[model samples]
Target: MTSLGVIFQPWSPPERLRETAVAAERAGLDELWVWEDCFKESGVTSLVVALTTTERLRVGVGILPMPLRNVAVLAMEAAMIQRLFAGRARFGVGHGVLDWMGQVGARVASPLTLMREYVPALRRLLSGEEVTAAGRYVNLDRVKLDWPPAVPVPVLAAAEGPKTTALVGEVADGLVLTGGWSADMVRDSVTRARAARSAAGVEGAFEVAVFLMTDFGEGAAERMEAEFDRWEFTGERRYAALGSVEEVTATVREVFDAGATSVLLQSRTDSDDIEGFVANAGRVRELLLR
Candidate 1:
């Protein structure tokens, strides 16, 4: 069976983080993801806290921007988190949106190139292998992790476009796809990714995760429509209209049929809209589980 995860957007204070983590576990979510945004708390800290508070939920930082920190340091952090959490941690790495990278004065010339070099380097470091590489963007000499992770850590690459998706298939263990993908797009991307992976003779199955909006209430359809309008108008548009329980179910089915192994529902709501978001998650969970 395909898995279902939740993206925890911490648009609130830190104190609420623990409560939200606990609530998600109670809601029967398989995994919980947090984002690292410039205006919000760091994803790593939130992930640590969430992992400590929850017993069985797998926690992931949806993405840690490549340019934000050194690759060696990232490997160390990943190792420590994996060890501390007793192997209930996953890492999602990506180039991040250009606007956010600009805030840190980091320029990503070619994301695919950076990922190709960085990911393998991080893996080597995590395995306690001496890494020495000279790439166009990143260069390192004799870097190794003294404390390697117990198991091979799953690294998920966030891909949106066709090129990136294909690259991810070639390199990454799985994919954390963007939110706006349609069923047709999802199908095509997955097929391409799988073919690339297969051609390369990669052993394990690839994961495809799609983000979707969820809302449940009397005026759920209106609420969803308004949300769609905002996303489209603001140029953050990557969403399928999942207005009702049936619609959400259909969307999930479409994605699954399109080759997604996991679907993560991202609850987009106001700061004070927790009740509705939770209700919507419950409804979607019912549909997905069914």
Candidate 2:
């Protein structure tokens, strides 16, 4: 069965996360994702709040900025979360927004190279293996986690372009596609990623997780239109869902049918009713289960 999740956009203040997470679990949603966007709340911190507040509510950090954090630091943090929460945590990493990276002096000239080196090493470290690499970006010296997750934790990477997507397939356990992609685009991306994995002779269960842009309640249609325009989204499909819970649920199903392993609903950042939005998402999850 395809999993359904919701993104707790960083745009909302930190105070709202606990209620939002509790609402998701109370509403029966499968997962709640948090963003580690630059100049925003820390994704790991948010995850702790959400996870500690509710049982059975899996939390995912959609994509941590690879340039800013040392791989060993991430390994330690992720390992602790896994040990504490067991199988309820998910992690993803990527080249953060270039402009933001530049602001913090963490930007690298070659993001693909950084990912190529960082992901595999991070995965190994999580699996309790010592990693020694002398790559262009990642330079590790026989570093291993003192306390690794008891079970393996799959590392996911975010990708928008073909090169990054293919790299994700070659090195990572899962791919996280951002919002504003149509179902057809997701299908094509999955095919491309699978081909890359095959060419690399990598074998295992690879997952494609998508963030489907969504809006609910009053003026949802207008909000969605504005969001699409901001995203410069073009095409007959619009790549976002609005209107009723049933409508958004249908869009989620369409993306799942397009080969997505999971669909995370990305709502507007300035949404007024965080709890209501989560409950609506729970309703959508229930509808999908039926």
Candidate 3:
């Protein structure tokens, strides 16, 4: 079955996370995800709070920016969390937003090279292997995690194009697609990722998790339209699902039918009903089952 989930946008203050977790857990939603927006809430810290407060909600820190982290240190942090809450967490890493990366002086000359070097070494470290490698971006000297998660934790990569999607197949266990794509776009991405996975001769399935722009209630349209204005989004409403719960439900299905192993509802950055939005995400999952 596809994993249905929601995003806790980092646009709000750090204090809002507890209520966010409470709402999703209480509503019986499947997963809760957060992004490590540069200069915003720390992704790992937010996951700790969310995972600790909820008994069963699986949380994903999708696409932690590689430029901002040391591969070994990132592995250690992920191991620590997964050990503390085994089977209840998901982690993803990728090239961060370039503008944000540059602001912090973490931007690299080549993002593809950085990800390629980081992923393999990270996998070894998390698997409790002694690894030593000196690459253009990542360098580790015979490092191994003293405390790795009991089982191998899956690593996901955020991808928008074919080359990066192939990178997901080559190393990562899953592929994450960001919001602002229509269902047709989702289908094409999944196809590209799978083809890459097959060509890589990799065993095991690769997950395609897409975040869909979704919102509901009275102000949904206005709030989302304003978001479009901020992003200078024009063309079509094909990518977003802004309306009542029933309307959003069908939109979720459109992406799912397009071949997402996971579909996460992303509330507009300025959305005021984040709690209510997540609470109703369960209805989308229900519709998918029927």
Candidate 4:
């Protein structure tokens, strides 16, 4: 069964997250995702609040940049949340926006190399194993989490490029597709991920989680069009849902049939009614359930 989710975009004020999270759960949203974009909210901090506040809503922090964090600290934080909330936590990591990384002096010459090494090490630590590795970017010495999750948490890696997608399939437990990819692009990405996993002899259910740029109600068309212009989105992969619940639900199903395990509806960052936007997520979920 494909699941539905909504994002509390980084551009929104962090103070706004709590109310919106409560509203989302109340509104019947399956999962709530938050960003760890540089100079914005701390993914771990915000997600902890979210998990503690909501009894059943699973909280996801999509793509915390490893460059800005120590793997040991990340492992500890993830373990804490998983232990506290059990099945209500999902965390992901990737190369954050490159320019933001550069601004903080955390930029690495090879992000792929960093993630290739970082993810496995983080996983090992979370599985209660001490990790010590010297790679092109990540290095740790005898680091291990004292209280790793009883079962290691499934970690998703953000990917849009083919190589990153393949690397994620080879290493991480899931893939987080960037928004603006068409259903066909989503299918092709799933295939590429599986191919890499199969070639590497890895086996298991690897999930494909994609973000769908969503627009609805008043001002939706102009919002969608402006987004396209801003993202410089062109070609067939500029995927978005721009109309009523029926249209958005159909788009979700199309992506699901094309091979997405979950679809997260992302409203524009400038959207003022964040809670209202999430409240409407229930509409999409309802149509999907039917």
Provide the RMSD of all predictions against the true structure, rounded to 1 decimal.
Answer: 2.4, 1.3, 1.6, 1.3
List the global CA lDDT of all models: 0.77, 0.89, 0.85, 0.87
Question: Estimated TM-score per prediction?
Answer: 0.90, 0.97, 0.95, 0.96
Assess the local accuracy of residue 150 in candidate 1 as a C-alpha lDDT between 0 and 100: 80
Model 4 vs. true fold: TM = 0.96
Cα lDDT tens digits, model 4, 1-290, are 78898988888887888988898899898898888877878888889888878889989998799889888888888898888897688988989899999999998999899989999998888889988999888789888777889876988999989999999999999999878989999999999999999999998888888899998786787878888888888887667977888888888899999899888899976778877778778888988887
**Candidate 1: C-alpha lDDT:** 0.77
Which ranges of candidate 3 are over 4 A from the true structure? 218-223, 236-238
Q: Best to worst by lDDT, what's the order?
A: 2, 4, 3, 1
Candidates sorted by TM-score, best first: 2, 4, 3, 1
Is candidate 1 or 2 superior in TM-score?
Answer: 2
Tens-place lDDT digits, model 3, residues 1-290:
78888998889788889899888888778899988988888999999999998999999997699999999888999898888897688988889999999999999999999988888888888888999998998877889888988878888889877898888878888888887878888788788878877887878877788888887877777777777776676765336887877888888888889998888898877766777787779777776678
Error of 1 at 28 (Å): 1.3
Model 2, stretches more than 4 Å misplaced? 235-237
lDDT of 1 by residue, 177-272 (tens): 766677787888888888888887877867777776665445765666666675673333445545666777777787788888777777654535
Error of 1 at 193 (Å): 1.5
Evaluate residue 211 in candidate 4 and report its C-alpha lDDT on the 0 to 100 scale: 90
Candidate with best lDDT: 2
Q: What's model 4's overall lDDT?
A: 0.87
